[model samples]
Target: MWSGPRNLSTAMMYSFAGRGDCAVWDEPFYAAYLKATGIAHPMADQVISAGIADPARVANACLGAIPDGKPLFYQKHMTLHMIAGFDRSFMAGLTNVFLIRHPARVIASYSKKREAPTLADIGFVQQAELFDQVADRLGAAPLVVDSADIRATPRETLGRLCAALGIPFAEGMLRWPAGPKPYDGPWAPHWYNAVHASTGFDEPEGPLPTLPDAYRALSDRALSYYERLAALRL
Candidate 1:
């Protein structure tokens, strides 16, 4: 999933990986690099660094690391992590799909969690720019889900997403047993609460994920970037 932050990318992953035929890998590259090297990311002070330590090295390792399975293989990836010296040739062959939601909600959700680099905190416009680059290269317009859409029409929206990706839809993709996956090491506390709450892809409740007051202006800029892409989809 690609966005400034807090766009429910991992939850989306959990949704897809729930399917019977999917061999889901969560943030595999991060751990591989961490095990291979001990270098710190720029935000190492705030975020725990794990996986393959070097971005380029991590990309190389991913070339053949995707799981082999009868079902689909689900890779829940972060765009910022992918472009850090990633192997474009390998990525070019991927069934690459972008997942996005409003920047305000994303940043707000991060703020609510007290996470760093909230959309406003990390320069959301730049992150959205990066997301655009990824979508263009993939030639597939992003899945472009809104938080509201997930809350309102999860099965229908996800069914459309699966159809677009040429995967057979299944009820299993609606939800899964939550808590920790093998590959989810550091992100559990910060991002897993909502994911764990799912008893099977229930519709979103309450309001959409929110943005921080501090990042509202940046969220506007970020949303502009998203709006441009949305124009194409429309």
Candidate 2:
């Protein structure tokens, strides 16, 4: 369960799901859950209009298939999607990995689409806190990984991730035939970039896109919490 937005979340999904031995469920709760609840999300209008409204059924489907040939399942999740009645207990039986990116980069990518939402509403602070809460209760502090590290030192970082999850790192996890997946199918044009064009992990030294003033301000403010979580201190 990697919780984040536009933070290589989709790419990471392909990386894990692409493996011959793993099964991937991309934000399974999104479409049905959003439709049934009609919950006002950050971009509630856009979200509900397009995806699932009943998330429980998705959960049921994943759990039901677990005993079969499903050795490992990588489920993509949105931090803000943890609305009322969305029971997270499904996490109890699975390994949890929390994916995080600097809020600046996240919002910058998000701002590219319709009705650009705010940091406060994106649920960054609350998500980070809830990640800790869920991880603590589940008896495993999630192996949180930085998106920058995943891009910069992918081999070593992914190797570490696989180790924490008790799996052997495979070369396929590091490289795939570039471009989108079934999930990336719908969002291709709106958020896709040449960066997302390739399937393998590439060096991230290129100039990132320019951001809005609101994003910079909110990112600077929200970063304090992320700093505490990902940084090592005495």
Candidate 3:
């Protein structure tokens, strides 16, 4: 699963983790991205220390055997983390799914966690690029599902997604035990409170949150990229 932050990604991770047959990995390339870019994030030092900083090793691990000999491996990836130097050749071997939320919602929720996000920080452009890459390689558009659709109708939305991926939709994915999971990355404490406090997808969002002018502008810029994938969502 590929997504930007605050886009229900953790909840979706938990959803997949709830399926006993699937093994989940949280943001495997994060440490490598941070190490390569030197951008400061909340808990940057601890994240780098706890994670593998070598992108090559991370890529290899991504293609390696599924942990615990599980039938399915669900890797939760941050689109922005695949920065310039990281090779994307590994993605061709995996089933790439893009998860999208409205940019206004993303900016409003993300700004509260870490202030003043830029275009790259929010990842709309990167996600669209990645989608195109996968589509070109496969000769078809890859799978995409909107966070809003998931929130509004999880069973139907995820059922369609599971069918596309050639997997059965397990009922267990609809809910999970509240609180943190053993598989969360080191940076979870800084960013996963809302998801950790929940047992399942939250209520469908109300009207898009009102943003200040600067953030509104950023959201406007991101909307086109979001719409492109959204139009193709399952």
Which of candidates 2 and 3 is the stronger one according to TM-score?
A: 3
What is the C-alpha local distance difference test score of each model? 0.58, 0.68, 0.95
lDDT of 3 at 59: 90
Per-residue lDDT, model 2, residue 183, is: 51
When summed lDDT is taken over every stretch of 10 residues in candidate 2, the lowest stretch is 183-192
> What's the distance in Å from true for residue 50, model 2?
8.1
lDDT of 1 by residue, 34-153 (tens): 333444433342233444555566456555555753346677665545433445555655665655666666666666566445343433454455546667785655555554566568
Compared with the true structure, the alpha-carbon lDDT of candidate 2 equals 0.68
Better of 1 and 2 by TM-score: 2
- Model 2 error, position 143 (Å): 1.2
Per-residue alpha-carbon lDDT of candidate 2 for residues 98-134, written as tens digits (9 for 90 to 100): 7777777777766666355766445577567766776
Whole-model alpha-carbon lDDT for candidate 3: 0.95
Could you tally the backbone clashes for each prediction?
16, 13, 0
